[model samples]
Target: MLSKQLTTCLAVGVGILGLGFARSNVAVAQEKVTLVERFDAANPYRVELKVRLSGRLAVAFEKGKPPEVLPFSGSSTLVYDEKVLPADEPRTAKAIRVYRETEFARTIDGKEQKADIRPAVRRMVVLRSERGKKVPFSPDGPLTWSEIDLIRTDLFSLALVTGLLPAKPVSPGDKWNASPNAVGDLTDFDPIEEGGLVVEFLSVVTLNNKKYAKLQISGTVKGVTDDGPSRQQLSGTAYFDLEANRLTYLNLKGVHELLGPDGKTTGRVDGTFVMTRGPASRGDGLTPTDLQGIALSPTPENSLLLYDNPDFGVKFLHPRRWRVGTVQGKQLTIEESGGGGILLTAESNSTLPTPEQYLTESRAYLAKQKWTVNGSDQPRRISDTPDRVDRFAIDAEVDKQHVQMEYAVVAQAVGGATIAARLPWAEREELRKDVDRIIKSLQIIKRIEK
Candidate 1:
């Protein structure tokens, strides 16, 4: 995955459809515009972020092995309902959290897995902002490093995108110097880079009967990460809702080139991040709806439990009855009331063994313990990882009667979080649907490195 904040900044802000408002049917208005920046304080702004990532990314893992080259094309949706306090010194969130749910899926090589993250992540964290900076702080203790980054990206995106508005009113064809600080904050602006970022006031164009301020935004940031030096450039058009004071739609093309010691390009990233803003789902007695009951898709759920771990960049939802504990600091397990549960872990190293290799060794160990492996290995995609599950039978004495109980074992791998879950025979029939629901909602975000 692209770096967490960088993905949201460059990839999500892009527009995919490539439709321009310069159609022959609409007439562009050449009028003076103030571009005042203010959002409704009464209602929480609900934003639906959709990002498309495609192209080959070179990921270096081990000391001797060659970098793994992975090709991926997928869309991830994140819903946030955040209400910003009125502008005084610095804007902050009154009460902001993942509004509807967090969902992501990717197809690596030829395997695909996705999950919903609401069940494991609490949606009640309170965000408070400090002076001067737009980063939102959560007074409610215990925020995962990744969750903090998620909140920061969301907050930063709002501020960074809105800051495109010019401080003074001007007419069409006018240009202004965008705040260097805002631009630098989002893109890690490089002072040595030529041609600083600028904002142009394009003519207002009517779209779908709504008035908008069309803008042309361009910027470049050349810097270096631990992996290598990189140069990122962004140029595109954005449609800002005149009345709403928010970016309604945006389409930007980005180029990120990995540089060698001599400042020459070695690898390049070409992708578009198209985003759309929707109404907020603040649980203020209103809910967002889906078309039909889409299985393995995001749907409505009654109140449950939330386990958010940002440092590992994973969050999940399980039933309130499930007990959460840790086998290892990063390896977590959620146990059922009287039966089986799930095992979740996060790994950054992609050079680890494949899922098939791990499963084969696991089955051999279980066979020695008198457990007979049953069923054929079928293709069923699990959350985030390429995974497979097998059935096994173990004889046990229950109520003084000999019985054969079935258990499921799964092991999988991905770039973000890896999951291993089992469904126990005792609760298989009664909690079958619950088991499916719990696993379907696992969410993963790439952890941010210092």
Candidate 2:
């Protein structure tokens, strides 16, 4: 996980009588920045959130239930307690974690309603590193259920999309993923396992001497049971400050439709959401590594690189020297020829699992397959709670090739799905240095597992 802790506008112009000419700052273009993603723990930002639903709600009503298409609008103010977690690895960049609290309020048909949500999900999540492209951490500590949903929902987010930014400075007409999860969540017309959205960089414009990134937002969301929308299409604009490395405001509008078995629209929703940040409340800046306490740097010597699966919400970094071998299904081979290597496999699904539960079931499955477990260890935790780790201690040969192996099976609880990563015996010691790094990198991306 990238380390935690830390971390819009509009204008109108009108030309009046032909007798007078006037200049407006709204016409001036804004300048770009060197680092717009930086955020400190003390200076948290506030968000003014709003969502409105209009248009007709297609429904079949037998009697008097009033008009189905009742216009609805809701708004809220949220504060994000953001902090940067410290990391010691050269290859692994530290990331920002955000804790959100919503002072929510809304209205429907001119009637104000309470904005009540399960408090469990309103937890802290680690944003991706701005220095590089890495999946942002959701509930960076011990992952939680509601928190996972919050991350997937990206409620009141800057549409930061968990650090899915342009490879370099971008100009008008350049495009990038709205959010890192977009490529997966909104693909091939699949059911949305969890709701999420993505933004694409459309262009840049200057308004009132301020720079703004004109982008498009789109995505797909299917519920975990595959019972949600069969298809989702979205689009929006984000006023991004290139110089400030921040998103001033975001406006998204889209329609997610649930199709009947016949693939016809059964339940459809048309909505709009906007997030605008208020003036920042400053505090002490970043905590230097010396004061990091338990959070220290990872050894950089022969460090492994993080390999993230954009779609499956799985990631692990292998040793730098390992070569890719056989690639089948969710299993893979990280090796240096026939000598010594590690065979690993990972899969994601809808069910939630405690580390202990996963270990128990996995052991049973392996035994049913005739694989003998010479030994095993009790499940342990690194960050605690839903982020527990399950270990499958091994001392036997089990592969089709019957290769003698001594490895471990580790599992970490993530949102929407459980990722099971298996390690074969061969390269256990050879690449042991990368074990911690790989294990820590195991997480579900922002996309839902469908």
lDDT string, candidate 2, 1-450, tens digits: 111111124331111111222344223223432224555444455544555554333343556553244444444444554444544444333444333455445555567766433343233333333332333232213332222333433442332433445546665455554443333422223323555554455545554455556555666655422343356667666666655566666566777565655667665557766665533443222234423443223334323344555654455555545554666665666564435565665544344465667677767876898887666666555555455444444444465533333234343444433333344455555445455555555565544333
Worst 10 residues of 1 by lDDT: 290-299
Once fitted onto the true fold, the runs of candidate 2 whose alpha carbons sit more than 4 angstroms away are 1-48, 54-77, 86-152, 155-164, 176-208, 216-227, 282-450
Candidate 1 lDDT by residue in tens digits, 112-138: 866443343434333334321333322
Tell me each candidate's TM-score. Answer: 0.52, 0.41
Question: Cα deviation of 421 in candidate 2 (Å)?
Answer: 30
Minimum summed lDDT over a 10-residue window in model 2 is located at 12-21
Which prediction has the highest TM-score against the true structure? Answer: 1
